[model samples]
Target chain A: MAAAFTAIGGKWKLTLLYWLAHGESHFAGLRRRGAPITPKVLAEQLRELEADGLVERVVTGPVPARVIYRLTPYGATVLPVVEGVRVWGEAHLQRTDGQSVSDTAMSCASSIV
Target chain B: MAAAFTAIGGKWKLTLLYWLAHGESHFAGLRRRGAPITPKVLAEQLRELEADGLVERVVTGPVPARVIYRLTPYGATVLPVVEGVRVWGEAHLQRTDGQSVSDTAMSCASSIV
Candidate 1:
C-alpha cells in the first residue's frame, strides 16, 4: 500500500496521471494541465514515474523532438484508484463546503482528480 | 487528490487504517499490527487521521482509560481505494518477484492493505 502510495503519492503525479489518462499525452499538454508544477519539478516527477514503470516517455522527430508521455499498462491500473479519490473529494467538498483537509495539494486533487 | 494523499499519504497512516478497517480498533492491537512503526509514530499518525476526520478516537472505562480508534464514515469511503491498491500491489509483487518498489514502507502497504 505504501509502495503504491510511494509510486503515485506526490501532490502532482496523480494530477499528471489524471490528465494523461484523459488523453493529454504530450509534454506541453501535461505542462499546461499541470499548471502549478514548475517545469523542473514536473520533469523530476515524470522521471520518477518512468522509473517506477507507471509512465513511459517517447521522443519523436529528428529535430525539435516532440516528447510524449503515456501510462503504461501497469500505470493504467491506478486509474480506478484515482477516480475513487476524485469522487470522494467531490463529496467531501460538498459536505464540508470545502473547509477541511486544507492542504493546497488537495486543491489540485479536488480540481484534477 | 493531494489533500487526500496528504491526509493519508504517510508510510503508517493507511496501514493503520487498514487494521482499523479490519476491526483491530484498540491501541495495543494497532501497535501489534503496525509492528514496524514505533509507538510514538503510530500515535502521531493516528492523531493526524483523527484531526482529518478519517479516524475517531474514543475513550472507554473509568481509570486507565481504554482508547479505541475506528474509521469515521468518511474514512470508510477510502476502503475501496485501499483495496484497489492492495490488489495492485499483490499483482506487482507477483510480476516483479517482489524486487521493485522496495521501500520499507511499501512492505507495510503490501502486508496491511
Candidate 2:
C-alpha cells in the first residue's frame, strides 16, 4: 500500500500513471497531454517512477532512440485503487472549477468531512 | 479522493486512524499499541493529524489536563478507503517476517508487481 501510495502520490506521478494506464506513451505524448508541465519535470518523474519499478521503460529502436513508458505489474496492482480515487475525486474535486487533480489533491478527502 | 488519499497516506497516519476508528484515544493509548513509537513522534503525528483535521482534539479536565483524539466527520469519510488499503496491505505486506508495518511501508505495492 505504501509503495502504491508513494508511486502515485508525487506531483505529476498520478497524472503520469493515469496516462500510461491507457497505453504506452512516450515522454512527449505525456507532455502534450498535460499542460503546465515542463519537459524536465516530466522526464524526472518518469525516471522516478521507472526506478521505483512502477513504470517499465522500453527502448523501441536504435535509429531514433524512441522510448515508451508502460505500467509494470506493480503498477497494475494499484490501478484499482487509483480508479477508486479517480471516481471519488471527480465527485468532490470540482469545487474550484475544473482544476486538475494534483491542484486539488488535498481537497477531495477534506471535503467529504 | 485526493483528500482521502492524502489524509490516510502519511507516515503513521493510517495506523493512528485504525486505532482511532475503534474509539477515542489518548496519546498514550496509541503509543502503547504500536511498538517502537517514541512519545515525541506520537505526539508530533497526532498534532499533524489534528492540524489536517483528520483528528479532533479535546481537552477534558481543568485539574489533570486530559486530552483525547477523536476522528472528525472528514476523517470518518476516509475510513473506508483506509480499510481497503489495510486489507490490501495485510494480503501483501508480510514477506519480511512479522516486523512492524512502519518498517515495511514501502513494500506493499512493490510486492504486488
Candidate 2 clashes between residue pairs 3 or more apart in a chain or in different chains: A74-B113, A109-B3, A109-B4, A113-B74
Residue-wise lDDT of candidate 2 within A63-101, one digit each (tens)? 453887899988677566555544544553353244455
Best by DockQ, which number? Answer: 1
Please report the TM-score between candidate 1 and the true structure: 0.65
Model 2 regions lying over 4 Å from their true place: A1-54, A57-69, A89-113, B1-5, B33-48, B62-65, B94-113
Off by over 4 Å in 1: A1-6, A9-12, A25-44, A61-66, A99-113, B1-13, B24-48, B59-68, B99-113
Model 1 pairs whose backbones collide: A1-B109, A106-B3, A109-B1
CAPRI class of candidate 1: acceptable
Leading candidate by TM-score: 1
Superposed by TM-score, candidate 2 places the C-alpha of residue B48 at a distance from the truth, in angstroms, of 4.9
Query: Under CAPRI classification, how is model 2 graded?
Result: incorrect
